[model samples]
Target: MSTKEFIKNQVEKFSSHITPEEFADLTEAENSLIILEVPSKDYTLTEIARIIESNNAHVMSLSVLPVSDGSTLLISIKLDISDLTPVLRSFERFNYNVIYYYMKEGEINDIQRERLQELLFYLNM
Candidate 1:
């Protein structure tokens, strides 16, 4: 089976056990989560870590789930940094198939926050 098919099958099974809110809560944690697929022959923990480190990030935890087809493995990684934009781009540049990723929503930008504060002061609410 192709990699996509295997990944799809696994995700389907996994989704049945968790609701969207539950899943969101899981991803909204301090650490970011990334799910990728790699050919069994090309899988290497060191290589993945090196790639993440290149973006000044570190992997908090990693789990490897072997597909039933035995051709590709799904790599689930939790990163210490919540901003996943840089890490996602780095993985794409390296040609890794990023199947899923979740980053906790960032707070309002400084300018936006300041504007809101000024408005609130005027309203005195």
Candidate 2:
């Protein structure tokens, strides 16, 4: 098999152990960057802003990445708690490519790092 397949296969073999402490670390505000993947062509800033306001969140920073298939947007929200479920559910109504993350602050252990690397591969980032 190819190296990519090999790595994915190996990554699937290991189970991740995330403690409450680790989960807390993931939601910590200091060094987290929230990733939002959405369809860029049909989406406007107004729609994005509406979604944020509807969910009672405000945007701090926004970055847009264009790809052949579709575009992905990264938003840094200055939120007390990094809760993405509401925002994601609201965005789903528009039928866009969506996923989110609050980037971990401290050094990512091997498993977390590997999972992120796998994400990069899948997203072609």
Candidate 3:
């Protein structure tokens, strides 16, 4: 199945109350969101959030994925475009292996946005 279909299934399983349309709206509102994927072995979700918070960035959502090698934490944070530099520097200081992506305002595509919305909804609950 496609990623969107997978997410829809997961959402249905986790939060049947949230409709597709509502998820869309939630993602739309979070256009300024940044996603960070960090290996769980390097840092726990709380530690990562604390690190981000120390740099003045707010973690809006966090989730974990377990794999054969190890787990990975997926986090969504709200931050200004300009604050990216310092936050990244902090990550480096902490020696975290992180992969990240973000879109400019009005630039988010449907699938990407929906996935983030599903993640936020899933993690929140």
Candidate 4:
């Protein structure tokens, strides 16, 4: 059992799933992850936290890493709640550059899908 625990993971595999280091607050089902990118000089942690808290969520953990682009930073935040729609909208409204975000897969709305399919079919004709 212990031998299997020390498994070797390829770099590619990490892209598709969260690894141990990023599994801090994500270990709980309720927490969700959001990664935002911004010019290091333009962003303030207080501003980011205020935006999230305004949307009624709390930050569980945060990690900031300087991106290869010397002037940019990647801010990874783990929020206490899983629903990110409201938070995402607030970020958009504030013109924040959100690079990536993830939560559990949401259920697809069949009605919306059907409508889109009909629209595409009509457009093709």
The residue ranges of model 1 lying beyond 4 angstroms of the native Cα positions read 1-30, 106-125
Q: Rate the local accuracy (lDDT) of all candidates.
A: 0.73, 0.50, 0.53, 0.67
Candidate with best TM-score:
4
Model 3, 38-104: lDDT tens digits are 6766656677777777876665544444434556555445443323555666777887654554434
| Comparison by TM-score, 1 against 2, better one | 1
TM-score of structure candidate 3: 0.45
Ranking by TM-score: 4, 1, 3, 2
lDDT tens digits, residues 1-125, model 2?
43334333322321125443364465443223344555555757787778766877666545554444445333333333355556656767766544444433332355578998999999995
Model 2 regions lying over 4 Å from their true place: 1-33, 68-81, 103-125
Off by over 4 Å in 3: 1-39, 71-82, 103-125
Residue 15 CA displacement from its true place in model 4, Å? 11
In candidate 4, which residue ranges exceed 4 Å CA deviation?
A: 1-30, 105-125
Taking the candidates one at a time, how many backbone clashes does each contain? Answer: 0, 0, 0, 0
Q: Candidate 2: lDDT of 110?
A: 57
TM-score of each predicted structure versus truth: 0.62, 0.45, 0.45, 0.65
lDDT (Cα, 0-100) at 47 in candidate 4: 93
Question: Which residue pairs come into collision in candidate 1?
Answer: none
lDDT of model 3, residue 38? 63
